[model samples]
Target: MSNIVALVVIRVALDRDDQQLRRWERKIAFGYRMFIGLYALAGASTLPVAWLIARASFVSYVQSHLLYPLVLLAVVEGCVEWGLSRLRRGRHTLLIVTGVLLASIAIYFNPRLHAIESILLLPILASVFFLSPKKVWLAGILAMLAECILYWLNPFHGHESGTTPYDLITFIVELVGETVVCHGIIARGAEIWEELRKRGRLETELLVRQIVSEKDAKTDALTGLYNRKSFNEYLEFALRISAETDTPLHLAVIDIDNFKQVNDRHGHLVGDDILRRTARAIEYHLAAGDFLARYGGEEFALIIPEMSHEEAVAHVEKIREKIANIHHAELTTQHATVSIGLCTYVPGEDSQALFQRADQCLYQAKKSGKNRTIAHP
Candidate 1:
């Protein structure tokens, strides 16, 4: 039951793919196996006390149980691991646990052995541990039947204490009551598990869809740069921060020279390749604090922060030169050029006015000569 909860939480948090979920599931399975091994060790530890109570030497107990719990541990661990690995059915595992616990009880079944009946709870617990209600009932029934048969036919205790019908009835009622309670608990836990699993899946699906929608809304499909809307939002943020911090900010609009002719002659595929390459070139020249966006077709925008006017100029110039030098294989020996218009932000200047100023500088660059950087004074 706890494993189910852990699985649901981990899947909700990290299950982006089937492979990732399987990794977590495997880890949980291994943890459950270790728990079973520990349970076996814990159960086997009570053996020496039972041995001493039987007036048997501890050495005899050790030898009888096979070298100090090692053999029992190996057997229990082997049975559990084999069931977990080879058998996917819950009833198969239930039977295995029932067998192991019943065998343990039978091993210590003697007139002198007190409270050996407690080991029968192991089957019920193991079933409850895995959160299987039907299996819990099966284990409880098997444990009661085994107890009745062993107590009825035991040669060591012929009509001894706890051998009467009333006592057997009481034991049966207790076992049945515990099993019913465990069954109910597991049934209720199963309901809660289902509810949480469904909720986690719905929430995860919604989160994933939201993430994809956000990406689509903010990023250009062609060049993977920020779209115009994202750029506008970022520009407002950059301007506000620059004013508040008294830091300088530069804005630039870059236009690819002869883009229409390239699209007309080389085709849209080659034009798209050129656009992607141009975006990469500009991005390669950018610092960590700089921002680049696909303003629109054949045009790009950039925002540079925390830089002096000279540094901004040198940065954009490097970009302008890099684009001019790209030799696209799709265009053979032909090349492309970009004209850049840059403007430093004035404190308290509105975004539209600042954008217009950069556009005006771009017009100047286009008019004077293509492939040149024009800065607004």
Candidate 2:
């Protein structure tokens, strides 16, 4: 019971966000439910023991003290669990009330009859789990006060002191020492939990930063496509895979027609805008698994896996038609067009040789005319 109550109090006191509280309320309530069920079973089991005991004093003691207080404790536990489940008000109030009742009962019963005041540990320890440190102090103070009041009202109060006011210096010292130890334990545990959370947050942030850095390294800033470095690396990997598996892979190099004239007539910014738009248009025509990258200034490289030489030509020609039909009123009177050269992978060919053949086909396309695809035989 002390562990469960203390944990809840700590959580509630530390909670600063309403959304987090709402999220945790159901789970927190489960602890309280378990406490109530176990306590109720304990109360019920005592009845059989009370009935079987034939001693008059034992039966009387059990009936007057044990059974009644157990019943009250069970009721308090039930009320607390209900309030927690509903997430309603008076939850904390019930906890405080329960603490006071437990303290009073412990002092009254005084199982050992040696320093009944030490029973105050029940509420003091329980309240330490609450969110606020203030509650812990409060619980200790109230428990001590209740014990003192009961002591004063007792017929045996002065009997132990023998005509002198009871000197509680020893008890007070012990209480202070125990309370400090409890706080120290709580403080240490809280520090460890906070440090772990901080470390976890930092690790998550570093992982995210690393991912973004890798993406930027592989991407072209101007066209937002894979840059030349990434293009070469991807081609090398794709060529190796093709060679090993004897899979069909097609490569294409595309260049904008009259690109130098467009840059000469207009500023570089306008030319850059045209290039970005052209990249988007070409990218739109590609299917999934096809790779496109900015190979150099005003040039793009493409790779299509699982395609024949004829299929590769058809794909590049489609992108050429799309680029040719683009109407850019801001830059040129005629629409921008691209010349594409496509070729299929030869068995066991290296990346450099494959790319060189594709580049030769592109040169042939440029020599033949602009705005058309030329395929290597």
Per model, state how many residue pairs clash. 0, 6
**What is candidate 1's lDDT per residue for 255-365, written digit by digit as tens?**
999888888989999899999999999999899899999999999999999999999999999989989899887775578899999999999899998999999999999
Which parts of model 2 are misplaced by more than 4 Å?
Answer: 1-34, 54-179, 188-205
RMSD of each: 7.2, 8.1
Put down candidate 2 lDDT per residue, 18-49, tens digits, no spaces: 44445444443454445445544754666677
lDDT of 1: 0.76
Best by lDDT: 1
Per-candidate TM-score against the hidden true structure: 0.68, 0.69
Native-structure RMSD, model 2: 8.1
TM-score of the candidate numbered 2?
0.69
